[model samples]
Target: MPSESSTLHTPAEARVRPVQQWWALSGRGVAKVFRNGEFVFAFVSPAFLALCFYLPLSALMDVYGVDYAQFLMPIIVLQSVGFAASSAAMRASFDDTEGINTRFRVLPMPLVVPMFARLSTNAVLLVVSLVCAAVACLIIGWRPMGGVVGTIGLFVVALIVGLLLGLLADGIGLMAGSPQATSQALVFPTLILGMASSGFVPVSQFPEWIQPFVRNQPISQFVDVMRAADTGSLTWEILRPTVWWCGGLFIAAVLLLRLGNQKVRA
Candidate 1:
């Protein structure tokens, strides 16, 4: 007869142990992030970005009657969200390239388990990035001017945006063929959207020719909503575009994840 320990390794046992598997995999992902020093980068990136923009542009922004510190907070936080999503993509890409995802497929556990574990890891990192971003904003003199409910709303919006972006990035990583390619693919768009958006300066600052694009882009809308939330001035007109953008992101993430899952099964 087969050994008792071997019998415990049957498919039925594996199916029952998905929770354990998810926890273990989540731990592994978190550990890898620490080992690779991404945890440190999570703190450093936001702080660096804040200082880089704040020191040079504060005087100029003040010329426009803007408090640069307050004006700059939303983008810094959003950039941190972007960082978390990029990290998620890299983690997924590494898993794909190293065949770790393939190995998981051979296991008897549900196909969704690994994806959930990765999402858990992404969630942890996203929260850390937001906290660090908050610290950076505080140091630069960004305060919560919107009272208790508004402050909570500010972060709630950020967390929702971060999670959706993370899900989208994870799907992209799985679909990409290589980690280098994944990084390149994400970097250009991130740079373009971030720089082109109203996050850095008022949309009126742009030339009349490009102003329409700058004003109407998704990133600009996100920044506007976040700023309104912080100042207790959010209106339906300001928030409607963001709601639609978020809905679109959700749909895109779901479709990409399904396609990625199919690619793996194939």
Candidate 2:
């Protein structure tokens, strides 16, 4: 048998695989989300949004010949997406500030493992948020006029959009110095985009000058695609802008993530 000193000097045979590292980190993230009460907020936020907007504005929207519940579903889903992205940002910021990221860096894990793990956590939260939003929309009288395929397409669009947003937000969180800064950085854009978009009301309802912006903005484009998917009227023209926006978001996320990786290594 080897002496105690020789055993201590020997390299261990056991090695942690990259997939195991990713899974472990993802489990940790999911646990943190539950422990921090973010999971509860995932349900509450969308339901509250649906109630607040549908109650006050349904009659007003009816004046425009809009089925308000149907008109409102996309925005509610998108808002939930925003909520998930915000949570991701906060998680990334906390990891950075608390030195959790630095600790991970010192481990034998790949640089991308933690990022992918966070993305898995974000995806899980996004799915929950979308489900909660759907329940809230149903309670508010939204029904799927979209056939089976159309309805599926609607959710597929929502999922893709949510995942892209989560990626962008994750990068933002890593780049931000603190959780407060992360929240602040996300709040304005989320508010301005959500409010100013045709998501709440039609472009015709906006002031003439801003109507142009409202009609063409990325959020509006997303809303338009989702609505079209719901009604089974999605066309190349309706989808083109959203595709472009998704591409832009993807590029931006990649750049930010690369920068974040550099910062971590530094």
> 262 in model 2: Cα distance from truth in Å?
0.5
Q: Write model 1 residue lDDT over 1-266, tens digit each, in one string.
A: 99987897886776669989999999999998889998899999999999999999999999999999999999999999999999999988888889998998998778899999999999999999999999999999999988888788888899999999999998999898789998997899999999999999999998989999999888899899889989999999999998999999999999989998898888
Task: Score each candidate by Cα lDDT.
Answer: 0.92, 0.92
Clashing residue pairs, backbone N/CA/C < 3 A, model 2: none
Worst 10-residue lDDT window for candidate 1 reads 7-16
Candidate 2 lDDT for residue 167: 92
Which pairs of residues collide in model 1? Answer: none
Relative to the true structure, candidate 2 reaches a TM of: 0.94
Q: Candidate 2 regions off by >4 Å? A: 1-16
Please list the Cα RMSD from the true structure of every candidate, rounded to 1 decimal place: 2.7, 3.4
Please give, for residues 71-157, the per-residue lDDT of candidate 2 as tens digits. Answer: 999999999999999999998889899999999999988899999999999999999999999999999999998799888998998
Worst 10 residues of 2 by lDDT: 8-17
